[model samples]
Target chain A: MRLITTYLIGLVFGVGISISGMANPAKVLNFFDVAGIWDPSLGFVMGGALIVTFIGYRYVLKRPTPMLSQTFHLPGRRDLDLPLIGGSAVFGIGWGIAGFCPGGALPALGTGSVDVWIFVAALLAGIVIANIIQAAMARTTQATA
Target chain B: MIETVFTPFQSLFGGALIGLAAVLLMATVGRVMGAAGILSGLLQPQDFQDWSWRAAALVGMISGPAALMLVTGEFPAVQVPVSTTMLVIGGVIVGIGVKFGAGCTSGHGVCGMARLSPRSIAATTTFMLTTGLTVYVIRHILGT
Candidate 1:
């Protein structure tokens, strides 16, 4: 039941992304190219999404539990950590260079583009490397303490 | 220097759908809709119990676009201005960054901001600023 609901939601999300031009790399790139030919369309997309989500979260959190799950699985951390800032900066550079974020890239696979395949493969490799680095960092911390 | 056409109506309509999708996920499944987090979970599976929903969501994401193509008889036009090597490098960087940051545009930008998470707000700001700078350097300064 939960899986079905999540699937349906994902479906809608995918469709929304497709229709909103979020799935287009050029569109995304334009959003970041402020000094260049900047397109403010993505701003509206973000605004529209934020407004709906802001209201939705407010109403949903008031309930004891979500409709299907026992509790809302929201992020709990609030610290301004180095990883968060540094990682986001790095991600932004990549986003600007390639014009593909995780959300945009994933749905784009449907288009069967070779470049998308290259990006996705490289993305997976990077994730694997990140995991390895994280594990090493953890081990070092454990050994030190 | 490049003239580009903007689609305000399409963006708003699509963005509203994205938000509605997020709301539906939260209201029904009790999960925050983070695309990077969802993809990462599918990558590094630790347990089977949660895999079902994650997989379902991923399948839905992929198929949703596929369905649109089938219905509209047109695929969304996409252009990657960078070279293949640049694309690969960018992809790797994005993968690593999202993993380290624990979220991406969807997780931090949309959902995180909605919840008013301080961490997400900071992350989103950092990325947006960085992206702007990066584009300026690449497009204007480097002229690439």
Candidate 2:
């Protein structure tokens, strides 16, 4: 019951981005396209996201936790380390090349284009591989610790 | 700072939509409402109970954008600067990075970091720096 709704809202956001010209991979590519009339719609998406996230948390914070679940599930803590820096770089590079970020991928797939699907498959493979690597690393760390 | 970073249209509509969706998801689904986690669920074969919602959510993500464009009007076609090979290579690298970091941008950057998760902060910062460096290298150094 609860879970269904989450996906629906997520879908709404995904669709919103797609329709507004944010989700299109080619369009996303346009921002990095510095040559033409650079379409900065994606930036608007992120910027738009940043604003909503800011206000949303503010309201969520006052609630003692959240109505959906337990306490306000703010992040666990803060640290600047290798993994963080590395992952973001990967994200940026990937974005530059394909112009298909995760969120944008969703709408692209919705368009039912072959290229989008190819990217999606690749993206999923990446996720699975990452999970496997992380699991392996955890095992190694635990054994060492 | 806000205005400088955000466009007028984005600040109002985008922000409102995000807030609306976030609050709605929490109310209806009882989840933190992050794209990375939700997509993960779709990727894995879930127990019948778990999989349906993920499937629906995944559908929503794709369909939502599509539907909007159809109704409103249309935008120009997409275009990529680099070759397919480069794109694939970058994706594979990002996958490795996400795995090493134990989360993606949406996971750590938006969801986890907002909660003050130490791991997320580190992860988000790292992702940002890497992105900046990579862009510089490609555009400035490599001049690609």
Candidate 3:
């Protein structure tokens, strides 16, 4: 039951991304290219999602616990830090260059494009490398402490 | 120089569905529906239960085109004008950045922003600015 719910949720997200035309890198890039042939459609997508999510989160959080979980797994961090800003900036540059953020990229994989495969393979490698770097940093902090 | 036509109706509907998906994830799994975070978790899963759902979500995402095909009678367009080298470089940068930043579009942009989290707000703003600047430099300044 839990797995089914999760799968369905993913499906809904995938369908949403497809229907919104966000699965297309060209469309996404256009949104970022203000000086070029700009498209504000992506903004509407974000706005619509934000409005529904803002309301949905409120209602869902009011419950004592989630339907299938004992606790809400929300992020607890509130402090603004360099990693957050710097990392996001880097991510943005990549996004602008490729016009394929994870959300868009994941759904696009279904299109059977070799380029998507290449990007995803590279993304996985990057994720693994980042994990290694993060682990090393943690160990160094532990050693100093 | 290709034109991207406006799609307000479809965008809104799709956005709402995505929002609903997030809500469903929260309601059941009690987890935020961040795309990169979910995929990242799959790389180093803590347990079976954890791994199973991530796999399911990914499978669903990958098969999403089939779903769309069923509904619309054609696969959604996926234009990749970026070269292979750029795609790899961009993918790696995005992977590392998302890891350090702790979220991506679905996580920080949609879910986090909805929650009114300051960190997410900052992250979103910073990324948005950099994304715009990067595009401007690439398209306008560099004229690539």
User: Of the candidates shown, which would achieve the greatest lDDT relative to the real structure?
Assistant: 3
lDDT of 3 by residue, A24-53 (tens): 888888998877889998998898889999
Runs off by more than 4 Å, candidate 2: A26-40, A64-74, B1-12, B43-51, B73-78, B112-122, B139-144
lDDT of 2 by residue, B14-50 (tens): 4346545655555444455556566666666558655
TM-score for chain A, candidates 1 onward in order: 0.95, 0.85, 0.97
Cα lDDT tens digits, model 1, A92-131, are 9888887888888787787788888788888888888898
In order of DockQ, best first, we have 3, 1, 2
Which candidate, 1 or 2, would have the higher TM-score against the true structure? 1
**DockQ leader:** 3
Candidate 1 stretches greater than 4 Å from native: B1-3
TM-score computed on alpha carbons, candidate 3: 0.98
Off by over 4 Å in 3: none
What are the Cα lDDT values of the candidates? Answer: 0.86, 0.59, 0.90
